[model samples]
Target: MSDTAHEDPELIQLLTPEGELREHPDYPLDLSHEEMRGLYRDLVLVRRIDTEAVALQRVGELGLWASLLGQEAAQVGSGRALRSNDMAFPSYRDHGVAWCRGVDHKALLALYRGVTNGGWDPAEHGFHLYTIVIGTQALHATGYAMGIQRDGAVGEDGSAVITYFGDGATSQGDTNEAFNYAAVNNAPVVFFCQNNQWAISEPLERQSRVPIYRRAAGFGFPGVRLDGNDVFASLAVTRSALQHAREGQGPTLIEAFTYRMGAHTTNDDPTRYRVSAELEEWRLKDPIARLHAFLTREGIADEAFLKGVEAEAEELGESVRRDCRELPEPDPLDIFHEVYAEPHVHIDRQRAEFADYLASFEDAGAEGGR
Candidate 1:
């Protein structure tokens, strides 16, 4: 671990809950007024996206949704820290990072709506499709980073890969294996762990005794923990980490200490496992609220602009609702479409068999009508 990482032993905070700004000497920041407001906009808009998706799930428009509530700053901060060339591998809940990668909200919704296997081309956007499996993206990212290294893409002009997983996923074998692999290979990857305190009812205490980031040290790299609710800290630390990776410094582990602030998914009830008091406490460190407070306190955003953001959020909500409804139901056969990049004889035979099986249903319906 970097010696300076211990400077803020408890937590790395650049923005207080009260909206006051704090700075770390190791991480200097100079954001334009517009840039700061833009960060706030990203936070608000992604939160709105999360809200709309949850509502869609409730209405049965979506099969399921993994909410990114209360972790907007962490996602936005790290996401925006990436250069366009940097690749991101996200877990199912990283809608905010997807938004930063310029993925269309409609496309993201398509997956939840069960309309598309994946909404966007990853290569085009430099963002991989959401990985539903817990910690598999870690291995995927590490492999990609090693590929980038083999291709001589590990310098200032090169690219870095970041993979996100929750605290619960840290216990997974794949995630730990990725950590060890990246360390040994000096892969240009960042293992971003959003320790939202619960892996579906299992608290952080139940997961690990040492801080998640500190585990990077054992693997032979630096790990840093930051106030995940503080957008400034998230951005600054991630940006620096990415730079380190690009410069051929080995992998870094970033533990964003945050809260889930909602159910594990539309299907799970957070109330069943946690108390209201815990929720209320994290609410005080709400990511969007802190950024808003900073903007208002620093006079970077005015009443009109703030109101405009709210109006925009409402507009976004409406658009998501309308467009999601308009999406065409995907063909069941589409699943066989991308099973492979090239068709093999076996896949072709299987597809034909499946098509015949599907057609039999139509034949039965015709016979019934007769």
Candidate 2:
């Protein structure tokens, strides 16, 4: 193990639970009134997207949906911190990050609805498709960072990559290997882990004995923990980390100490593993409430402004519902279209076989009618 003294001993916080502003020595966020309100808007809109998706899943429009219910600030803060040149590799539940990357929120429904393998072109938006495999995106991110390094992309105009994972991924071997590779190669990647306490049903204590951020020390890089519910802390810390990586500094591990207020997915039940009291406690620290409180307290926004945000959120929810229902189901043969970049004889043969199989079913139905 490496020395823990190098990392912040406690969680880095900026905005308190009660909406009071506090100063952090290392991560200071100075934002204008407009910026503050903009952050608030992002939080509300993202939460609306999540809620709509969950409802869609419940109504049989989607096969499944991973809820990012309480981790909005962590996703939005780090997402807003990225520059256009920066690449992001996200886990399955990072709908908020997809929104920040300018991806059509409705398009994301295609994956859960089983209409498409991936909803958007990653290269177009600098955001990779959601990775469902545990901790694999970490390796992909590290490899991409290495490519950036090899391409001489490091300095002011260069790019960095940020990979988002959860506390559950910390226990995976791929994640550990990625950490080693990034550390040794000095790859410009930020490992942003949202330690939302529960990984499915397992608690964080089952994943690691120590705070997840301190794991970076053993990898020969700096690691810091922050109040993932506080957008100010998340944005400031992620911005600083991205800058450090772009300037050729090694990887940094940012463990966002958050809570998963909902079930792990549309399938799991939180009541089975966790307590109601824990949920109530985190609800009091809700990300949107804190930011709204700060906005109200600071006189940055009035009742009208707050009401407008609620109206916008409602509009967004409606839009998502309409768009999700409108999405066309893909043709069964469409799956073979992207299996190869260059045509391969074997895949062509397989596609033909599948087409013949479908035609046979149609032929049988016609003969029976005759």
Candidate 3:
């Protein structure tokens, strides 16, 4: 209904775009000086990771890249709110969440570089692989949450599940089905939707008449609309939502009202569907800039500390660029390596046939050159 998230009355914001700090009664957060500085560091570092990935895609090193440029605060805040056992199912653009879960940045580069399907162990980090088929992760998270309940992990301090999706994905059948299942079964899941104002070329107004958060009421769950650009609000609200789910209160939907400052993916051209004026407007609410402003204004981070973070980002970017090029070339037949936990005759035969087919290519190349 409003031009920006800031203008929405229901949107919870603890940090203003102009860098002033505020308080919300429902979602109170008391971060220490060190923690405040850490959040700023988290925002800066994730943006650097995005910048390097974008550059790699442009130079032909990556197959494609989905940037989380303006949505850093939402991802980092929600990610940090989770407990160690809590699981996260992220869409492709959720690199910031992966970082918070201790995933190596080089691992992300390897995935986009086509060297690996995914570079981290989901079980180890409690963070799933980047889901390319949109909205499917919602169902996966719901199932996992149901399993958590079966395991008797539905009490105080219990583990919960959080799944990320975009505004457009709210229209998908799979996501809606998951919501129904989670609500009916009282599964421990938090459906985190980053309503970044656009789903590729389509605007939010075209997808749903009401805000995305209100859709939760129809699914028999509570919903919240928060300023996604404010890290403090994101962290506090998500913490409460996950706690509600863990206590067997069922599903909760959190709509992070933010903007996508970059193209949907490396192959996309935002300029074709959007205009420069809109981009300029959202730039004022940039997550990293707002947090940095707060940290500096409050004197929580000194010049030396800021420079240290910048140097670390530069070092990380250089490492990503170098290691990305060094990632081993994937073997085409490697796809057949882990088809099953145990061997099966059909798999064996299929592997052999595929190998023979690949050999035929080598023979054809030699003969053709001769």
- Please give each candidate's TM-score: 0.96, 0.96, 0.96
RMSD of each: 2.9, 3.0, 1.7
lDDT of 2 by residue, 1-370 (tens): 1211123458888988888888888888878899999999999999999999999999999999999999999999999999999999999999989989999986798888999856898888899999999999999999999999999988877899999999999999999999999999999999999999888999877779889999999999999999889899999999999989999998999999888889999999889989887788778889999998899988999999989999999999999999999989899889888778899999999999999999999999999999
**Cα miss at 96, model 2 (Å)?**
0.8
Candidate 3 lDDT, 1-370, residue by residue in tens: 3458678888899999988898888888978989888888898889989999999999999999999989999999999898999999999999989989999988898888888855789999999999989899999999999999999987887899999999999999999999999999999999999998889999888999898999999999999999999999999999999999998899999999999999999899999989899999889998888888888898888999999999999998898888878889988888887668799899999989999999999999999999
Clash-forming residue pairs, model 3: none
What lDDT does each candidate get?
A: 0.91, 0.91, 0.91
lDDT of 1 by residue, 1-370 (tens): 1212224566888888878888789787778899899999999999999999999999999999999999999999999999999999999999999999999999989999989977899998899999999999999999999999999977998899999999999999999999999999999999999989899989888899888999999999999999888889999999999999999998999999888999999999988889898888788878888778888888999999999999999999999999999999888778788778988888889888999999999999999999
Cα-based lDDT at residue 251, candidate 3 = 95
lDDT of 1: 0.91
Weakest lDDT window of 10 consecutive positions for candidate 3: 1-10
